[model samples]
Target: EEDKIIEAEAQKLKEKFKEKSLTDKMKDLLIRSIYVEMLGHDGGFAHIHAINMTQKKNILSKRIGYLASTLFLDKDNELLILLVATLQRDLESESYLEVLSSLQAISRLANSQIMTATYDQVHKLLSHSSDFVRKKAVTVIHRFWQINPNGVVDIDRIMKTALCDKVPSVMAASLNYFIEVCRQKPETYKDLTSSFVVILKQIIEHKLPREYDYHRMPAPWIQMKLMEILALLGEEDEETSNQIYEVIQMTLKRAEDLAINIGHALVYQCIKTILAIYPNEALLENISKSIKAFFSSESNNLKYIGVTALNAMLKIDLKYAEDHQENVVECLECSDDTLKLKTLDLLY
Candidate 1:
């Protein structure tokens, strides 16, 4: 009912924008109203409003540009070409802010044509002298690769250079990109095994600066990505398996002092890596103990992770399902829907 009312008002405001007598203040307010209620809105008036708002020389106008482009524009929209043109013009500017904003807007609203047209500029920004520009550039590349992997030219070279970057933010962004690419083409990164494992070990062992911390803890996202990549690379090779096993053991040991949610994610990914690569009785027992410890944690997140890990373990060996039956059954009484669902899965 409220959305319908907002839509009605938005329609009225659209008609008001057509009036030549409308003041700039009234126009701004109308844009804000439409911006707030952009959801479920499919009117063409927003395209003109966003374009007008974007042309104004102010921060508010720039923000409106971002919001409007993200909310109102899609690949098939006729207005996308205008948005792309504006972004390209901004990118060509010498101002860092302009380039950054353009980079951000493109990341959010880029279509195949936008990606293809702006590819070289973003690629050059990876090596930009400013860390801020480089970081944003790496992120844009990552987003672009995700949407169209083949759209990114020289990705192997890009990944290799990004991973070797001195900045933590740059490295993290590159790792994220690498994780995605490796998911689709795991064998393409086999050559980086030794270097990748070394970096993962350093990160897991807390050897990096605080910049790497996700939430005041070691970077769990990077750690989990590395574990996944390791699982792929080490699956059938005894030497690689040993290397990953040691890293997993260290990660589990470090989980004791970490934040509950972070610890749970780490343990969950660690268990998955172990199961994927080398699931010996000893490794399984180690994961079993980790999950049991998570169950004992006061944090529900940990408990959910525990249940999830146990559910996965049960698939590998039904004996685990039997061993942890009592504990798993207790989870059914929890109020958390996800935990309840996983517990029910375990029970059945």
Candidate 2:
């Protein structure tokens, strides 16, 4: 039944393309609808139409074309090679939106072939005038790194520059990239620890632009990513651990004061970081208080996070779990079975 519907839709799309009178707006609409229908199935018939759309001067048509191509073609698809020139042209286009759309398409459809063909063009966009372009470029580089690690030369140089990018969105994207890289080789990125610490300090002080604020929290996503990266780098390294201790303490204190859900999330990330670094007794007690507070929350999500954090803390020092026994027991009565199961794991 589904395949028959897709065939009908494909045939209608083909007929629409045959009509030279069809407006770009109408073409875009038809392409979008057919794209949705073609999502999971083999959409070989619409491939040529999608390719034709990429050749159109209309920006909307180009976007739909790139999107459709992403859906129809995988990394290994032979047709992907044909997109290399078009993608490269858009990557070098004077328009930032065009460059952004091309980067996005490459990021999603990236394979060894695409990465090999567009490596330099994508790399050059890292310094594009638009922060939006720069941000997307960073993610494309990250994808390229994943596709072919050896292809991305001078990674340390690339990351150092990206981490210091003035824009919050770019910085956040770079941090995500760094998190992936550092997870595999923490020692290589330990030198960049001070840089991350400085960025976190700036964020904590509300130095980022007002636009980046989420519910009055200054770039909460960036803060969370920083904490995660710090955890990875600080693990079993005393000097790296000591350098971030003060900032981590400040983060915990700040996170504790906010009443919003983002605040709770920051607090949870701080707890995980505290565990990774050998935190002092005072910090441990403070985190314990935060975990206990979660148990009192009406939100099951908060309760679940609290239970999970407590379980992790116990592994470091079973004594911490002793204080949460009552809270853990209270969780057993919650209606969420997943939360109850986590509580059971803590009990065991």
Candidate 3:
């Protein structure tokens, strides 16, 4: 009886939700009940709520639209059909916020038909001259590719354009997608290695938003991702390989005498890159020494990175790597399960 009463009240609120006369606060209440409060939701009422609120002209309405689209939008094509029209309108609207919400909805929903239909709109926004929109578009494209790689045409061109985009964030997103593409279709992207190396080098040497420091290093995320990409590029090309080694050496030199997780991570990435691109006794010695320094780090994250780096060297130069046996055994006493696993890997 109580459940029936609650259901009846929820239905009444859903009816009130459809009224244009309903205030934002009232609609927000309805949305919170279904999306936040976890009220028993009728699919029909939820669809009505989504459509009615999404068509309204306010941020609250759009917020509700996003919430409905993500939480309660039905799997059937019927509700999505209504949403696709609204999303298209939002995409074409002059308001970037509307476009942003639409993209967010599309990304979360992962409906292949919606992505295919909105491809042109997303492609246009990729060059929309707004860094915010472009970055979102880059992410949406990546999501699209993840959902249905075949649906995205001219993907290489899209990635190349994003990589060269003037905005650093755009380039970062582009590199993320591009790296995946390289992993999937290595042969197709080999020709672009040299160009990507140059881009990665530029980003490493002097990328902006330089104030966003991680472990006292500016933008370590970008630096690490760039280093990973460089390793991939250097796998075949001698020129690229030599350039990668030089960058790794330079990064290692800079990271020397540093004491931060990000700096250790940078060194970690550098050592990993060197192993991938140009593994040699001399380089392994440097990496082994660096990993030794990292083992002494108080931070578990740095210590784990140290263990991982040492393990990579163990596969190549077991003679030199054997020197770290005591340190690796000591890591077995660490609390972190991941570090323990890495230590076991090193030992076995």
Clashing pairs in 3: none
lDDT of each: 0.75, 0.84, 0.74
- Per-residue lDDT for 99-154 in model 3, tens only? 88888888777567888779889888998867888988988888888878788877
Q: Which pairs of residues collide in candidate 1?
A: none
Evaluate residue 29 in candidate 2 and report its C-alpha lDDT on the 0 to 100 scale: 49
Give the clash total for candidate 1.
0
Indicate the residue-level lDDT of 188 in model 2: 88
- Model 1, C-alpha of 193: deviation from truth (Å): 2.3
Where model 2 places Cα greater than 4 Å from the true spot, the runs are 1-11, 14-20, 23-26, 29-35, 38-42
Q: What is the per-residue lDDT of model 1 for residues 1-348, given as tens digits with 9 covering 90 to 100?
A: 878877887777677767775545544654655554566555566566676566555756666666666666666777777776677777776777778878888878777888888988888888888777888898888888877888876777887888888876677777777667667777777778777788878887788888778766677787887888888877666766776677677877776557567776787888988877756678888988888887877767778878888878877887776666667766777788888887777677
Clash number by candidate, in order:
0, 0, 0
Residue 332, model 3: Cα distance from true site in angstroms: 4.0
Q: Please give the lDDT score at residue 104 for candidate 3.
A: 80
TM-score per candidate, chains pooled: 0.86, 0.92, 0.81
